[model samples]
Target: MFARDTDDFSPSERERIVKTAVSPRPVAWVGTRDAAGTDNLAPFSSYTYVGADEPSVLFTASRRDGDLKDTPRNAIDTEVFSVSVATADVLETVDHTAADPGPEEGDEFDLAGVERAECDRIDAPYVADAPIAMECTLHDRQEIHGRTMLIGDVVRFHVADEATRDGQVDSREITTIGRLGGPYYTHTDPVEFERRY
Candidate 1:
């Protein structure tokens, strides 16, 4: 057996361990609108579905080199954001948006070649061809050690017609890409099993 105190590792090493040991995490292609009405696209693996009954999710946006990023900043200004599920279908393009382009130069959608569709309940837009998209409003935000935790309440969800059965989404229909350690990723495939609980 082996053991280690997380404090023994440097910050970057701990990040690597967490991202790898977490097994898989959903990639949220977040959408926000800039002050000039330009749309910004950014994919975040540091995200998770937060609430079941209320339809909510949370994503962490951390300052890079002491500079705040636009996605969370836009959400702060507009009080709304959109989430487009990042599936294998858009993996390459989604990965392209992960590169930071210095908030002032260009739109990520243009650089990534991903088209955007207007969100139903929010001013922001989501990836047009995503299997699932959510329009969310900023429910709360907390600053913890310079990271902005954006909690959103989903106001509207757009699911592909073929991806649902009996009002429940068929997760198998859309194979999502999960972030792992640098330059690595994983896929999500559903397996059926009866639950004892």
Candidate 2:
């Protein structure tokens, strides 16, 4: 087995090790609207639900050269954002949204040629083709270890008909994508087992 001290690694090496060791992380294809009402979309893998009863989710955005990324900046400004599932059906377009397009270029939605839909309970946009999306308003934001951790209360959910049955989501019907470290992604083929007490 290989053993190494965390303090021995460079920043990039530490990031790579963490990302690789985390295995498959769910991709949060986040959406927000800037002060000028321009829609911004980006993908963040460091995301997870903070609570389920009251339903809140959190995603972390690492600063770029000591500046907040567009998604987090807009989210903080507007106090609203949306999170769309990154399904395999739209993986290519989802990846395109992560590109840092120049100001001359259009927004992520236009750059990726993805159709956008207005989030029902928030003033944000979401990927229309995604299997599921959550409309949320910012609950809190804090800087943690040079990253912005934004928490949002999920106020509404938009689920595709095929992904739901009798008011519940059918995970089997949703072919969601996940992030696997750098430049890699994965599609699910679930292997199930009965839970035993």
Candidate 3:
């Protein structure tokens, strides 16, 4: 095996290396509304749930061409956002929203032509067809290494009937998509195993 120090690579190369090594990452389809009430939708794979019980998640938004992206800017200004699970069925739509459309170009929801619904608890929108969507209130925002990391406390969850069983969500029932290195994506097809203590 051959490896070089992180400093050996340029920023873009370093990002590619890290993304390649991370295997499959869950995509967070985040939604927010600008102060002008323009809805913004974007996908961020640099996301994960950081808390339980009260339930919270965090996603890092990076500058596009050295400029702050609209999602984080809206979340920061409005203090609210929504997250919709990116499923395999909507992979193309999810990827479409990744493009940076200027606020003047038009909101991504209309650009991508994906159906959206209003979040009950927040002044934001979510993918109407997604298996799971959560409304969250901004809990904190921090700038690190030129990236904006925003944490949100989940206020409400909208789980599709088909995605839930008994009283909880069954991952097996949802065919979610995962982001791979470069331009690759994977779908969840569970390989069950019994764990023995």
The models' CA-based lDDT, in order, is 0.89, 0.91, 0.92
lDDT tens string, model 2, 1-197?
A: 87899999998889888998896989999999998988899998999999999999999999999999999999999999999999888888887889988878989998989899998778899989888899999999999999999999999999899898787898888988888877788988878978898
Best of the two (2, 3) by TM-score: 2
Q: After superposition, how far is residue 38 of candidate 1 from its true place, in Å?
A: 1.5
Per-residue lDDT of candidate 1, residues 40-94 (tens digit): 9999988998997989999998897887788999999999999999988778898
Where model 3 places Cα greater than 4 Å from the true spot, the runs are 102-105
TM-score of every candidate relative to the true structure: 0.92, 0.95, 0.93
Off by over 4 Å in 1: 102-105
Candidate 3 lDDT tens digits, 52-143: 89899999988888988889989999999999999998898899998877767788998899889999988999999899999999999999
RMSD values, in order shown: 1.8, 1.3, 1.6
Model 3 Cα RMSD, Å? 1.6
User: Clashing residue pairs in candidate 1, if any?
Assistant: none
User: Order the candidates by TM-score, highest first — what do you get?
Assistant: 2, 3, 1
Best by TM-score: 2
